[model samples]
Target chain A: MSVAHWMQYLPIEIYVAWRYMRFNLKQSFIVALAVGIGVSIIIFIPSINLSFFGYFLEKTVESNAHIKVVRELDTEARNRQTLKTLYPDEGRILVSDQSLTRRRDIKAYKNLVSEIMRIDGITTAAPYVSESVIIVRGSQTRTSTMRGILPEAEKNISNIEENIQQGSLDTLSDDQVILGWRLADELGVNVGNRIQLLTNFGKKSLKVSALSNTGIYQQDLSTILVTLDTAQALLNMPNEVTGIGLKVRDMYQAENLARLIARTFDLKTTSWMEDNAVFLDQIRMFRVIIAFISFLIVFAAASSITSILIMVVASKSKDIGILKAMGTPPNAIMRMFLLQAIILSLIGVVAGIGGATFLIELYNATPYSKAETFLGIGRQPVTLNLEYTVYAIFYATLSSILASLIPAWQAGKLDPVEAINQ
Target chain B: MIQTDTILQTIALTKVYEGIQPVYAVRDLDLTIPQGSFMSIIGPSGSGKSTLMNMLGLLDRPSSGSLKYMGEPTETWEEKRRSQFRNEEIGFIFQAHLLLPEFTALENVLIPLQIGRNLSPARIEHAKSLLDRIGLGDRMHHRPPELSGGQNQRVAIARALVNTPSIVFADEPTGALDSTTSRSVYDLMREINREEKVTFVIVTHERELAGKTDRVITLLDGRLQSDEAPKESPS
Candidate 1:
């Protein structure tokens, strides 16, 4: 029979690569494990960093509205004239003293709040009255931001129920109020303790309903919560709100939604991201640094693979020569070594992802409180991002393929006459 | 004489080791191997008999020569074509047998067929039959390190014939064996040559072994000294 007949079946290159690994099991294990450690580092760093960012952002967004719409400030308004119209001889002034906007409040804001809530991605639209007031509790007086809200609609936007420690937002009434845990501590008051809120417009006695600690230092320090009727009575603005606080599903879309709200209502809008632009920029810089460091680790691991495979080529040169002498094509020789690299990398990537997940799980499982002091977060969240793991697979596989190129070429170019003698 | 039966014919074949001072490995050599002929090339060390064997086996190209295989000039063949022809028509056994240490005796025997891209069950059975014919059928799964020198050489013989090539070159086929093992290996090659009608070209320094061949060619200092038929054949 012709020896060349029925000549299609298996890929000999993979077989050879697999057998070579089986022959030198220890060396193959060490090289693959090195790649595993590198991949694990790539996966571990960014997941933890992003989790930290997520924790901080959660604390940040809860302290205020994602998008707040208010009357435009005179200093910031594009139209300095506050013109009533283009016709001046009509004797119509844009603003006059009594019945004019004293609070600069969004009038008939209930309709505006409902309108804002109907916009896509806007989860909550709660009208609020904010006033600078002096709190007097047995002569321990401090100036604080007194913010009033309709407790029913308010709890949905800021998720105030989760942060309440001493009492609950459910039982809040027009005569009751909540205080920041730190502010309550400074005034030495407890739930149901009566405190006097004195504003230039009026002074009122209110009962402390709840104390909240949102895991944010500034918000916990100086905030004084009140019912909307109480704040409206203090500010002397009835049936009106200073602003509408809008919440969205995605905080990253807050700025765009803020612009949309501004254009729709002809009012000034502020997004939390715009307010914390510098901090977010710093976080972005941190991510870039993390990614760069991961890249360096990948590059170093790939170099080590090249070094180890070159040693393999040196050790197997005689076998390569034998194959060549038997008329195996040079391309097959290259495939054998490249396939060896791919196999090793796959072993490493699986091991790496598994190891990183275990570590992250262990971290999340631990009961620890130091994260609050260190990162200003109640819990240092360590997230497992499969997206970064995909990147890990790509980086590791490509690195191994590239690392094997030179050594595989060297193996393929072996001189049969010279190598067989060795 | 180059006749119709000629399987390998070379004219003025030259191989030079070029360097600071170029050394002539094989120079101005003309040779022809007839089909189904069992022949030996014998010389002392540095006699270039090994180089001549490598060139004839198509493992190495000569610097200047016209090497014709089955009346086709092979000098201008590309690497892929040359490798294909080598896998299809030529077989080789070195002094050490040179089995891949990772593979079993059976797998080593199947290397040539695998190189030819034939892994069919029938070809595998043919490989097994060659191993059985060489009396190493039971040892087919054993690795090279596990087999004795004579056993390994026999396996090499099976490997060379598994492809059923037109010509096979054995370079010091028994150079590492004891006297008894060498005799057995030599007799096995003679048996295969006669039974399979395949041409055998052997390079060795053993005159006792060379004397049993159908013909003997001697080389000295990169030149062919003589070529003549022996008066007696192997019993």
Candidate 2:
């Protein structure tokens, strides 16, 4: 129902407070305006910072696997751990050795993939074989990393589908390949054309079925996609495939889960979080700084409330006089002023939420540079969050009550005889 | 101790304002007010008439000696007890600033009962009847600023009687009105006094109005000078 109709059911002190504010709308609006500006600042600054951070992080983690399982790092890591135990000396490690570079495959790879899939937080585990090869498009050859994949599992673990600009991954086969758009542009090859793949063991002719632009500089220029069976035959490892790539529920949990996977499955795991530690640390520091600034703004708003309520108490002393003479207790008088503070803050919370939502909508509608996008996606979702908005409301209200306490007490203690004369 | 027939009594009630030199506002004042009596107190300026009225109405405490309400001693009552007494047992009216400016006349009349949080439909009906009796039934919804001075004073009177209190202390109840309004306000109080059997103790400088009550009290320099019938001379 309407506000006036709802007001009739309130207790007497609250009713009196509403009437007092209605009698002095100009003053109440000014105080509410101060609080509203503070609240909007709290919401708007965090939203923008987190939105940009969120977009950048998505781009960093979505273009590649959260965790990559490999064989080379696995044996090296195991030897290092064994040396640490044998030496047991804090100052140095002994018996460390390096092996000649040889292409090694995870044995019983299909069985390992199934085992990795069953682990918690692992959404999917795709076994992929990547080999360095040269593409010969009319004898203009360039080296590229050719990735072989079970198309369905690779699709689940990566943003390859979203990055596809022309043609489709559905057409990819043993003889079909996906080339990065920039690489195709450099080679003067388009979809429906053929490129010769020169691997160590043999040569194969592949049709270009799709082109993608993933917004990652190296990936977009030096990567090609083929079927898993095609790469195994070319590498002459028909019974073996390369390491697995993982998709996880939480990107931040990738590091810890990687440690657990290395210990559980006796394999090495690498997380993207370890690769971009400096950037992530900087974002975390920015978060702390922003939270501190928001607190100061809310504290300033509370100070404004204290001053405003003090002035109101001084102005309304005459009303206090008659109320006391009519047998109203000092506590009731105090409650009247405190209730006004609550109502004022409630108005500010609403106005702040409304103002922040409106401004964020306008910001989201503005176009940003395509280079800053994740997976070349168009819009970033940067708006007021429900959780922090609730916190803002609670803090604003509590501070207002605390700020108005002394003034309300003064109003209550006023002598009826003196107040009336004033 | 107080007599059962008396509504209020004071034994040597005194008030002193302490400073570099003490100034006595009231001293050694013993007074007894009988139930359902219409009386008026008259004195020159600085004669403690207002001070005594304040003590009797529980708005101020006496510095020495005890006051009794309905035979109960009130010397040690806390503010909560005094406020309770003021809300339930007594009423007060002043010359101006009597009603809250924000509330309508009807709501203003409901203040005493509402302050105690004991308002019922019967109390509301009583308030409406009080206003109607004082010729303010039509203006019940109008605020004090919207009404004339006399009309507002009548509303104050309705407010003072809304709780059906045994005694109402009126300090210059008609002090701000003209002679015609003063007469009408005074006449309405006497009518309610006869009909409801409520006691009224009026403080006024107008001897002509003071002469119309059943009893007239005269004070001089914080001392009671005489107690006599309304026929006695204050002129």
Candidate 3:
């Protein structure tokens, strides 16, 4: 049929459906309400899951580099006889073919980065130096993991500058450190304020250069960023970086790239997804359990609709008989009854979606407080998503269609002879 | 021209119900009804009058018979074909009036036309005219339960004629009404028959009603006892 013709046919179908529903007002309302609530819950839960997943991703990315390079650390740094044996005599940093060494000291880090960049789909590689240091602003001092990087090269590997609030990466050259927003707030320091940094080897006073605010509250508040050269000098690890952070073209491709890099380097490399497998699995498992519970709601609503249809079939037996006697076909009679169920379900679904949208909007607008905070922190804002509306409508539509099938079949099977006799 | 005389014809029509012992509700009955005729089938409660009426109305299929309407064989007809035939050519009224209580009087009258015919303004006007003719013009918007028993039956008659069926089957149509109301309903049926020249086959247990018809067929134990023309006209 042409779309126009089908569109024209809709009103008659609706009228027929409306009349059928109007025949039993109470039954229709009950079924519609039950189905509506079922659809609302189904839609609301998925949205919350997606937001929570978003929160989890942000935190994982903040804690680690885009890709961490794993390699063996040198055991003995400074015994001249052992250094000659391990580092090689004829201008080589190391003699092992498994390691990529540079003829010159500067070329060693460059060689490592160049080798990593040669891998297909590897976007950028940069050296990252890290060490645990005490950040002291007067008498108020806190233990923190200080990470240092080459600002320009690190841009490709991390979102350090993007996360900084009060200062830029250029501030690192003036013996300055970028602190997480929470850590800076706790220290009561502003941009250009001086703070003393103490490592195991020595102590140096650095200016508070930036307040970094990433949504990952713990990492945002606790970690500090400094220059890789300065970190190496202060921590007494000269001409050495702790690890190299590498970037891939896609975040999702991290695990695959990590595995390939691990094989090439002959070292253990863990991807972000692998590191946070338990958390993601918990979210997935929770979604499955909640979705199953939502299915029960749909089932209850569908059962109620079925019961209404059954009752309508029973109560309207005489009318059905009259129609049959007037030569109404079994299929037509079935369609009339089935149309009633579809009508009820459609109304319920539409109302549910509308109601759920309103409620979700209200929830998103209103601030929600958690009784116990996440990560030993206080409650934060609730996030609502549009995708939940789509999910709810989709599930409701499927459930309604499924609910009408048995009733339609039963109506079709009614014997006109027996029905009229009753 | 196609012959109009044999509007209805049956050859050895039989309907048997299966049970511990099978019951023969209608047995080997051969009957024919001509166009523009008024006929009544009369019998006691179990004499198979209703079963015969149901078969004639196409509401129930006979177990073994050659039932034909307008010269077309009905034994092998599919559901849609049967429905089309019934929709355009057969009308039925039952004992309980069976007016859908939710619909107004006019809507009830328009049900068959709306279901079967390609409805236009004229068809709707015709329904209104039928309602007005049945003295329900002012009550056209009232629901069946809101109206009296007699008024509800009148709505049923209006619905029956809405499609302009060639024949109407009435199975104890006046069974629920008082005698006075029954007479009035029968009067309306007779008036419509005379005016429209439509055939009517009324199934009733009342002998007085059977006596008033142009002809009567009597059944006893699923067997035809008599088929006689009325000796006198209705008073």
Candidate 4:
């Protein structure tokens, strides 16, 4: 048939489908509702899980740094490199890669950053410096991971400024430090308070100009941010820095940018995702598990549709025989039933999507107490996102279509003579 | 070569129902009917009259014999070719009338044409003309249940004739109607046969109707008993 003819006759298909639904009202409603419920459950659980994961990822990136590039550990070596050929290999056996500590050339690292910034999409780059330092206020002392950052460069790369719960991020003097809220509470310290920081080299007294809260518990409890120059002086390493972080225009292009930086600079580079592979993999695995469980509901829904269609075919055997005897091809007969299922499924899909959207909106508007963390973060309400809602609709539509196909095919495969006899 | 004079011809046609002991439904029956002829095959139930009609209509295959349409043997015909032959050359009216309850009278008439040929404006016009000829011009929009049994059968007749096939197979076409309606339906069939020059082969146990036909073939069990042409009553 010509496209225009099919278009014109499309209503005939709908009319036929409507008559089927009307004739078999209970069966049609049961099928549609089953599909709708399946769609809702399938979409809701995973979507909520994703939103939580997204929230956690964002909090992690915000609290610590946008990206972290650390030296890869070698379990076989106590030092950075092994000259196995020269030494005939002391054939080292290792317990864990984390047990090794290695040093790299800092000047080569700076050159690496410069090369990375030359890539098309890279806009800003910064270095991070970290060390285990003891916080001493009078007689009280606690160990914390003191992260050294270049204030101006770090500001260009992350939302560090906006995430500051208290005090200004730009207020970085030589003797001033930013203490994470949980860390400061442990030390009984506050903004403008003086505390002594004892590193491997010696002790240095510094004033806390800021107390910031980054929702992550571990980071908030054990972190202290200091400027690179001041941190270099504190650690007795005049110009040494730990790793470089990059900022790109698109977050989706982070992996590509990481690879480009690695190739251009000949340095070990890692994106935020790679730096936390196990955690990301766990999130992905959880989604897959959720999808697998949700598919049971979808499968049940498809089966319901198939059963209903089989019944309809049985009941309408005489109709089919009549049409076929009038010269309706088997395919056209099949399409008619297929279209009926499609119409039923389409209604369920659209209704499910609309219902989900409404629930999500209501959930967004109805504020609930934010979850308390091990860190000293106060309660904050969860937020709704437009992007995730769109994703839910897309997934619901795809699942609905997939669920309806088998039943339609079964209906299509029905023999007109056999059907009429029934 | 096929002569235009002969509308349907069967050669050594047979049908066997398989099981542990196979049942032969029809065996080596050969027949020919000319265009515009009205013929009847009269038999009791299970005498294979329906099976013969099904074979002639391309609805079932002959077990070990061939059916020739015009001149071409149909034993080697593919599914699509058999479908095409059924669409273009054969019309069928069943005992139940078998009108699709979902469609209006006009849409029912258009069904065959729509399946056989993609619907054009001309084809739709042709369907309307057929419905009008069957005296359903006013009730074209009514569904089958809304029409009387006779009216529904008339709609089926319009549907059967929509493609203007050369021959029609009627299996108790008026079986579901009252006696008066049955007579009118038979008269309409005879009128259409005379006017359109379309051959018709009817299957029935009604002897009076059989007596009015040009020829009557009676069957006992699975075999034909007698084949006789009508003679003028002794006057």
Candidate 5:
């Protein structure tokens, strides 16, 4: 039916429904309170999930590269190995002998970096060399992953410069290194202290120029940063780099761009999402579970509303008969109850939204220091999302109206003569 | 205008309740009611007086046979149309007053007008006038629970007359009131019948109240035992 037709008798219906609700104040309050609790849960869970997800994404993207370009594997050597495995004697005779130590380095990376920098939406591209090394200070030694980076270009791709706790990264010379705060603590060294670095080629004494803490436990515990020249000299591999790190304007587009870059440059590319696939999947699953639980809570609240309306219909049957005897149509009777449901739901949703907002704000304001111990995060993560709140209210209202329908129809179908006689 | 003298007519109307054995509540009754007449229906507890009253008031459908209003057969009319006819032409008053306890006396009186459509200022004034005529002008603002039983019944009477219907069906309108209140209620109904030119069909067990109507209809065993005008003062 058109809204106009439905609204023809709405004023009177609303009047009667409002009077009934006012007359039964306690029951109406209970229904509204139940709906409010349901709404609060719906708003609270998703909003917290979104905030946590956003925080994780921000930390991951800040600490790591948006995209990484690595050297592709040698397929010719792989084919030779496959042939040797397929036919032992005959394949060994047919295959040419080749060295297994193919270089694990990107060639012409400087030119590639310049070329990739010209692409739209690509902010920066920086080449870096990674190697495992041991550090010694006063007989205390620790093993760590040492990264060799171009100071200026790496600053654009990673937030190490911003997270530097002491000294500076721009002044990093060939003989100086930046140690993670936790690594520095383990090695018993401080900024400006000299530490002996041992690699496969030779040993060198390097001075700690800076200490950085990115707030990631693993990175802080095992990372040591140095200049590209120092790392190449120490590893005895000059003019060779392992990979190129890339930053993009839009972080979400990293995967698609990584695929495009791999196809165009014949390099193996990995995006941030590919690097953290398992964690992202867990977050997605957690979101689905929270949404399901929220829906159930809302459904239970709707059941309470249904029970309340059914009681009203049963208790008001005599009034219904009197109204019918006074010539009220069945549809009008139905609309009257429906209007009551709508009013109750509206009150509930408003109250629920208000309560949820208050609770979220209170949670954010409280200073809980052991958040990392309790929730695996250092600080409170809660972002207010208007859209989720609106959706929660909408669902609560729609479900309440649907729940009220059966009782409303039953009241409408009541036999006036029997009702009055009863 | 083609006006029929009869307001309601029923021919061999029957109502049977089906169970282990069928119980006939109203059986093969032929009756006619004229315009602007005051009448009463009287019977013992199980004499089918209520069943017949319900049928004539359009609150219940007969098991078989034809019923008509103003010579137009009503058996073929839809429930919606029947409700509309009741709203525009018939009123009802039950034994227990049946006023909505949540509403004031004035609002109770305005129920029929409100249900029929939106109540205009003129209709509200008319409802107020009816309350005043029923000697409940000061009690109009009081809810049913706040008013005495007699006052609540007076409000129901005012509500019954508010729509200016052609006929009013009152089933034991004074059955719950005291003797003095019941006598005053009967006198009020008689005065309304004379002044408003409205037909009133009442069902009651009190012989004294039944004898006061212009015409009295007596029923027994689901059948009419007597239909006659009492040879006494019409008041």
Candidate 6:
């Protein structure tokens, strides 16, 4: 038969199925509730996880460079020397004399930066020098890592300018430095206060020009920023850079782009994701576990639907017999029950999505402090993703259809004579 | 044109139940039912009247021999073909009325047409007219559970006639009704048979009801005892 002709038969099946469900409202409600709970969990857990991870990812990516290109250390000589010491009589090591020479800086970093910027998806590139230094203010002394950067170039890659709490990065001169808010507090110094900075070369007195707080405890505790020229002059290294920081338009592509840059430039590169792989893996694991648990709940809900359908089929055997005697085809009988399942599942899925959405909105509307404590974040962390809701409904419908198949088949296969007799 | 009057014929039809000890539910029954005929098969308990009805109604296959409808042998037909034939050409009414309680009286009458996929508005109106003619016009909206036993039986009768089948097999259709209700139901069936020229085969244990039909066939111990018209003497 043509599909249109088959479609013509569906209304009667649907009507009968709807009538049956309406007749047994209590059982239908119970089955729908079970499916609703299952669908709610399916929607809730994933959406919250996405929100939590999305929030943290935004913070982490904004606070740091998306990709970092560093000078590759000459480790071959050291590794070979250790191997020789460990296995002296094993063999002769085919080590090249060139391995002993260490390349401590990237040559033509300006050109390299321009070349990297030409690559698709790379937004900005900035070169900087990073080293450990000691800060002295009166009798107080603290060791901190200092980064030397061109203020204008640094603005493109990092959010330091926006994070500056006092003074301004644009006004920084060669004789001035920026300190983290907590670092300046530990030194008992404010902006415009002269503080002595000690490097491997010698001590230089520089004025603290700005203080910044990036809302991260570790960064605010011990970090100082200075101009690249002054840092090069202090370390007696001219026309050289220690590393280059890059920002990419697509943060998720950072890892692959970092690997590409490493292969292209023969330099060591690390993306933010690689630096925090363990935490990302943990989040992924949690998502998978949540999905599995949600699947189990849906399966349980499907079982409940199955049992209810079986009971209805068993109780309605006489009706089935009469229908058969009336010449209702076997397929129509099956379709009637399947239609009931689809309708019940649709109701449950809609209710579940609505309930989950309301709960999400309620969670987000609560006080920040309470929500922060509950979600372990600085703000609410539950985003309502319509895609997950669609997925939940789709799976619920599929499970419900599958659950009703056996019972519906049995009903379709019933012997009319025996059923009528019973 | 002269059309054959034999609507159904059975030749030495037998049905055997195989169990711990095999029992013959029907044995060596040869019968013919003419078009537009109103007949009753009557028998005592265990006389296989119900089994014979089931075989004749296409609800069960005979164990041996041939059963034909309109001169076409039915034993070789597929289940789908048989069901289609049954839907288009046959109707059945059981003792319990067997109306789907979920459906109203009108919907119950339309059940056969609905299954046949011919439920146009005209057919629906015809169903309503059938109910109206059966004295159920005002109660067309009531479900079977809400209707009296006799009213439900009338609905069943309307349902049986909805498809306008060639033959309707009613198995003790008024068994659950009172004597007065039973007489009324029989009168309705006789009126439909005469007006529509539709054949009807009724199965009953009540001899009085059997005596009312044009022809009566009696079964005893799975065998035909007699087939004749009722005597005029009032026993």
| CA RMSD per model (angstroms) | 4.9, 4.6, 6.4, 5.2, 4.3, 4.1
lDDT of 6 at A164: 87
Please list all clashing residue pairs in model 2, or write none if there are none: none
> Model 2's DockQ?
0.44
Instruction: Judge candidate 3 at residue A313 and give its lDDT.
Output: 76
- What is each candidate's fraction of native interface contacts (fnat)? 0.55, 0.43, 0.50, 0.28, 0.62, 0.53
DockQ value of candidate 5: 0.49
TM-score of 2: 0.84
CAPRI-wise, candidate 5 is medium
Q: What is the DockQ of candidate 4?
A: 0.32
Measured on C-alpha atoms, candidate 1 has an lDDT of 0.83
lDDT of 4 by residue, B64-89 (tens): 87788877788898766777677777
lDDT of 5 at A24: 97
Best by TM-score: 6
Model 5, span A136-190: residue lDDT tens: 8987888888899999989988877887877888999999999989989887889
DockQ order, best first, reads 6, 5, 1, 2, 3, 4
Tell me the tens digit of each residue's lDDT in model 2 across A19-113: 88888898789778877888887788778877777777787688679999976446555666666676677245543233322345777788888
Question: For residues B1-235, could you state the per-residue lDDT of candidate 6 as single tens digits?
Answer: 1136999999999999989988998999999999998999999989999999989988889999899988989999887777777788888888865999987888888777777787776777788888889999999989988999999998998898888889999999889999999989999999988888889899999988888898999999889999998874122
**By DockQ thresholds, what CAPRI class is model 1?**
acceptable
The residue ranges of model 1 lying beyond 4 angstroms of the native Cα positions read A1-9, A62-64, A73-79, A82-104, A138-140, A165-167, A188-193, A215-218, A365-376, A380-383, B1-4, B231-235
Report the poorest 10 consecutive residues by lDDT, candidate 5 chain A: A1-10
True contacts kept of 6: 0.53
Task: Give the TM-score (vs. native) of candidate 1.
Answer: 0.89
Candidate 6 segments exceeding 4 Å error: A1-10, A73-104, A368-377, B1-3, B233-235
Can you write out model 3's per-residue Cα lDDT over A1-422, one digit (the tens) per residue? Answer: 11122222243334456777876788889988987888777776665666656665765565456677655423223333455776576345444432333211222566677888899888877787777899899889999898878988887566666777766876568387888888988999888798988997999898887788866778877878888877887877776677787777777788999988777765456677787788878877987887788878888888887777778778887777666666667777777766776677778888887766777677667765655546433333445456666666677667776777777677666777687777
Candidate 3 lDDT over B171-207, as tens digits, reads 8889999999999999999999998978899999998
lDDT order, best first, reads 6, 5, 1, 2, 3, 4
